[model samples]
Target: MKALAGDLGIETAVSFPGRLTTDELSSLLGTAWINLHFSVAEGWCLSVMEAAAAGVPTVAYEVPGISESVVPGTSGLLAKDGDIGDLTNRVTEILHSPQHWWASSRRVVESRGWDRVAEDWERYLTVVFSSA
Candidate 1:
């Protein structure tokens, strides 16, 4: 990754914080303007949710699990998997426009929270248990 970044003339910072506590992770996420996720597949991306909670938008490929978290043009923009150009364009688009960037951040903040998730699960579980 470092070599690729250098070849592209992009500056890179490599940190090997092997493990981090939740608080440490939150603090790190809070400082980021955007999170870039390039995974081919994921069941659920806790990192993406964490980034959203920190009011940082994400840029990721439009894959199944990732798509659910990052709604294109809402929480973040999505590019076709393996399309580096599209991904680069999307990132540039968001970073170049403050209005778009803040709008996406606002959407993420307004859309989900731990309280909301718990309430949703509680409601669903209540129905399931009652039916049983």
Candidate 2:
């Protein structure tokens, strides 16, 4: 990986933190401009959710679990699965325009969180109990 980065004239810093605490992960996410989720298969990617919660948009493939969190052109952009060219273009688009980046960031920050989810769940439970 280092060799490939060097060949591409990119700098890379590899780390093996092993396990990161929630606070540590949050701190790392806070400093990121964007997050890249390349998972071909995932189950409700918590990393992507955490990135959104931290106001960091994502560039991800249009796949299950991931699609639920990243709303294209709102929270971030999505590319066809396995399309590296489209993924690169989407990422470049986000990086090139500060206005677009800020818009996406704001959208992500304003999107539903745990509080809203819990409230919705409570409402559903109440309706179910009352019906019964």
For residues 1-132, what per-residue lDDT tens digits would candidate 2 score against the true structure? Answer: 567767777644543356889999988877778889999988887787778777778899999998887878777889999999999999998888745665566566565776777888999999999999
TM-score of predicted structure 1: 0.74
Off by over 4 Å in 1: 1-12, 98-103, 106-110, 118-132
**Best candidate according to TM-score:** 2
Query: 1-132 in candidate 1: lDDT tens per residue?
Result: 667767777744644456899999988876777889999898778787777767678899989899888867777889989999999998997787745665566567565777778889999999999999
TM-score of each: 0.74, 0.77
**Alpha carbon lDDT of residue 111, candidate 2?**
52
Error of 1 at 123 (Å): 6.7
In model 2, which range of ten residues has the least summed lDDT?
Answer: 9-18
In model 2, how large is the Cα lDDT of residue 88? 97
